[model samples]
Target chain A: MSNLEQKPFNVREIREEFPALRQQVYGKNLIYFDNGATSQKPKLVLDAINLFYSKENANIHRGVHYLSQRATTDYEAARQRIQRYLGARKSEEIIFTKGTTDSINLVAFSFGSTLSAGDEILISAMEHHSNIVPWQMLCERQGCVLKVVPINQRGELIMDEFDQLLSKKTKLVSITHISNTLGTINPVKEIIQKAHAVGAKVLIDGAQSIQHMHINVKELDCDFYVFSSHKVFGPTGIGVLYGKEDILYRMPPYQGGGDMIARVTFERTTYNELPFKFEAGTPHIAGGICLGKAFEFLETIDMEAAERHERELAKYAEDMLDTFEGLQIIGEAKNKTSVVSFSVKGIHPFDIGTLLDKQGIAVRTGHHCTQPLMDFYGIPGTVRASFAFYNTKQEIDTFVEAVERSLSMLK
Target chain B: MNLIEKQEEIIQEFEVFDDWMEKYEYIIDLGKDLPKITETNKTEDRLIEGCQSRVWLDSNFRDGKMHFTADSDAIITKGIIGLLIRVLDGEEPKSIATADLFFISKIGLQEHLSPTRANGLLGMVKRLKLEAIKHISAS
Candidate 1:
């Protein structure tokens, strides 16, 4: 068999890695296309979760007992793994968070609360609600201005417009490295460089990017980076925020409570060191520990090979769907991850999604949380099918067949 | 109106929805009859943060009744807002507080909304109730 056709890395072997992928949805073999929303967990991640609870379930950081020490070791080791996964310089730079939303909010409230009036925060038109809302709330509170860099018809960021939006007054430029709605992989390195030249911090939202691409934070030189663990085949309710050592040290604590404090008295208190300064209260301990297993699982795969395989499938799915009358694919970015958003003429996206679900070929239908992009396109929503490495060619074929069948019903 | 009376009013309003959908050419027409927000009153302060549609919301209390005027950039979303206004508009704070707008899942209106849109709708309802709570407490 040819490399792509070979079962070497096909769904059968890949399916074994993910316990959730074996189940049936609606009496049909579940074809999960919601990877962009959150990926299904692998066996390793699940085992890690089970293993943590079975052996080491105590609260982290404080107890001198065996369970607490082991738990602290596992949690910090997970942080170290993620640090290496993202190629961060130190483990101290990584802060465990609830997810990308929490990570962004942490930065906004902690870092953004310090900004002065007339300071500008630049973001793109295609940001998810999580990325957009936190900055807006910060702007409203801090008297800082929020500027948007527009995207072109193809859903790619207009570099000129982004350059135009950057200035000395810009305090931060937070942009999605890969759009969840559109599959566009942005030029984040250049975006970061331009922002940094003006003395502004840059936070790249990697909620969608981490799955498809290999990210090296040091190479990118982004001041801050955030991504949800769930999107990377890890457990939900856990994520990581990576900041440069200098910047993280200067930023204030996000939540004030236990574990984050170094010295506490009725009169005064001092915050803990680098990462724990931000991590307050009891965190999603099991989730954070399992996040390491997710990185380990991803490390085993040939990332380039997977990317090429999915790109080919995406293109094939695109061509097949294009054969249908009046079907338009949105966001045809030249460089993209494995996501396809499309709409059929004279049909609501929800109708198409419901029809697809009946056949067990799941897909997301709607704005995909980028409403400004939807408004720009003048459509109510688009049906989005996002692929992961484990997704098969046969699944794409089934998806196309289902789409055709669904369209016929609309007729 | 009392609890039983409000439930009856809701049942009647749902019955009128079919007729409203047919008679009105656009969702905004339904909105036009529900309430109004004068142009001079438009501000960024009233803009909802996360909605994909440009939803303009303005509220005022007149004679113990809360009035809301909302307009969306999209038609279906507008229709949804119209449905919300019909259910939520003009009701007293405590009565509107007890109303289950999520019950639209039973009527199958939310069947069409994506999870995100549904969440947005929920957020809008929460904002409306928050406004009501503000006024109710002030009084």
Candidate 2:
């Protein structure tokens, strides 16, 4: 079916799917603009959570009992669901972790431990601490050098610089596919191609990318892609680390415990196969099961249309914020997701955020765990208002009005 | 070590947090009371990196308990740092280990904090806990 031929998503029907959207905060209908951090759960996802605990709440790959068998089936089914969602060739490529932070740490410990001294790991300056810190730790321990590809004033990566950084010593090229702070959509396909030209492995931090638009891992051909479930309208405590089978098979287990082992002996223990090798302890069963439903919920929507709507909202937000005197938008990327970052000249970002919260509009104000990016901009922090498809133009209007009210206080 | 006694003590202190305006007013006043750190202590090494406000924390462990003296460039932040020292400074290493500091919710401070400031508080607490953990492990 053609992408245009697809039916438009029913916003009311979709809004009904998320019960939390109907909530009242401070006697006003809650305006949730924090979708970049973590999205609200849909009814299907929340219901799946309840259903799993009520019916099939048993540990996977353990017992011959009916519940255990059922649980194992559901759990593996969730992996397959994710595989289809990301367009991965095989389900075995998916390794579930706590969140994006845990997934990055796994790669750092498992694959990064193999990197020797003088090896270089290249990452972009726009990466979240989750993406940057793990590699920093690896560099510190292994003596592997850490290098960053710089971004321009508009928050876009300098492609030529990134190419120059990728050389024989470059072991890995890890970068965020979409910058959380700046809303800059990076060229991952081009990045992967250039990195591979030098025989370097590439890992795309999809924590911000997955929600903005559709992704096909097979098409990108990156060595690995990582994302958090909570950011994609699923529950917390679960994330996916998607790597090609051969790569995953070569990597060592991150954490050793009950489930990750194939055989246990005081003398020599054998590790479990593929994905199980990475996932240790009793898994987040309910969270994993609900995440399958969240993926299903997203799949039913018209992603391209949703992307267009978000872009429209972002443009409107930007135009509105531009009118204020001494107000500067932090990232003016021509291509962006639904995030708007700005700083007021005289007022502190915290004071602006606090004043906005009085009008029941929640916005994030800080370095956003991107300290290096903040330093690059030479600003303390920016007030960030991120939008989702479910958000409306009216809400944007409300947001702008609140900013005007906040400006009066500053003056 | 008695669970009930500890719970009662925590609860008693926790109740005073109502009317955050009043509590924060008192806290800001307390911050005002602090003698500002000398210019020599305000170097890059003293600055806590993740904080929204410039917080300088220096500690002395006396008789097996950690004593932290902290100040921030922002007034309310300085007050909160002072409150943190009052709650955390004299506690045993193990007591600090098992502490349910998420009770920032119960005390209504969590709601008052901008997510960033809440994150700052969390970072502050985490740093303090790590110091206690280090002390416990070394001993």
Candidate 3:
């Protein structure tokens, strides 16, 4: 009542808010367990997307017309919403791009442009391909060495190894806040402190963490944070890159066209200010508004309760699956999120995933775009059943039962 | 039986399953029955690309017939691979190259028919046809 907060954390009530969950696949109710890859959109965000297209569809920031002004207001307001959501210093700190991969590439190119030959960029072994490849490309271009912090069998980053890797020569330390495949929550706060000590800036890939936890860039003191709108219950093709205002001012424009310019001429060009310096072209205007609506939707939830429920789901699934003789849970970090990734001794994850899909219990299979992590475990892939707050234990029961049946058929 | 007859046989076999689980279980059994490619034959050159599961298909032409042996890491994929080989194997090279795989859809397995499906059935079929063309040109 006080602030339009969503009713207290009730899974049943919250489930009603998402319309996608009420569908059937193969005559069975769909049990979507792919939150790590992307979350299902809520009705509020869906309506916002439709409303923008139906009524407020116009190119933003340039036109003085009523429609453009309304679109610009909503878009800028969305930027501010993201800023407030992340506890970023100003709306100027939030720049929208085409999802997390684009966000990482922006930092890699712009911030990477600042680095010189022989300077090092440190990342962990568990990062998604987006985080790894961008830096690798940067290292190739700039002649900067890319060092990876190794992880234990439990899939946790070896902090001591990271400490050894972080030195004066290290220019940046980019790591994931949570492993999308393993659900291991990295100690990004400590990593930020250590990186700052060694005078290296840090970027936390919050593509997986933002939806599951509370993030305050000011408190975390990270140089940059990136996430995708689709992974946070918003529309696809849009994401955020939250960088410190000071750092963003120093970096050059990523793409040099359209909105990202201050003034353009035949002779010379000047880049735009803060966020606009990075955002080029029209951008996904509808996605921006809907993502803002998503953050507003997120405001209503009790994240702590939601997090606890998700953790319980993971634990409950893990315990149940462990009973099977050859099933091995991949990421067993003490501090993990609601992701249960497991491999059976003789079964390929693709087989399990295929059968699960036939039964309408959706899960992810294969390398999950982290082939190196898969190689670390000496397995091709694992069947990953990642959970969101809306998922319940009963669904877990069906999934476990389906796994058992699938195993029986495979065997 | 000819290629079309074999495909029709598969469709008829699948028609009796009232639910998907029973159908997939039958596929799993067929996968188990498929003669696996030799470890040496499962070389890099034999592996099909664009499949989520590793699929190694070995082809040979003898007695004017195109023979195919396949293996997959996943049982379900192997089952589907078995179904493909069932339709395409033991046929003349010309017939193998021109065969219509309409039964894949008829068997309620339309999901695997797309060129975009990561299981690479379409890719495997393409490879099988290419092998057939090679044999046909040689003759």
Of the candidates numbered 1 and 3, which has the greater lDDT value?
A: 3
For all the models shown, what interface RMSD does each have? Answer: 8.1, 4.5, 1.2
- The DockQ score of candidate 1 comes to 0.07
User: Model 2, which residues run further than 4 Å from truth?
Assistant: A1-7, B1-50, B55-139
* Candidate 3 regions with alpha-carbon error over 4 angstroms: A1-3
Interface DockQ of each model = 0.07, 0.11, 0.76
For each candidate, what is the lDDT? 0.81, 0.82, 0.91
lDDT tens digits, residue span A1-411, model 2: 111133576666667778888877656677888888889898888888888888888888898999999988888888998998899999999989988889899999999988899999999999999888899999999999999999999999999999788899999999999999999999889999988999899999999889879999999999999999999999999999999999999898889998899999899999999889998899998888788888888887899889998999999999989999999998888788999999877556765676577577888888889999999998888899998888889989999998897777445
What DockQ does candidate 2 score? 0.11
List fnat, each candidate: 0.04, 0.04, 0.76
What's the CA RMSD for each of the models? 7.8, 7.3, 1.4
Most lDDT-accurate candidate: 3
- Candidate 1 residues A361-384, lDDT tens each? 778888887888899999988999
CA deviation > 4 Å runs, candidate 1: A1-11, B1-139
In candidate 2, what are the lDDT values of residues B1-139, reduced to their tens digit?
3323444465467577644344545555676777676778767655565456566766656789887777665565666666566667677776776776544555555643445554355556666777788889988
Q: By TM-score, how accurate is candidate 3?
A: 0.98
Which ten contiguous residues of candidate 1 chain B have the minimum total lDDT?
B19-28
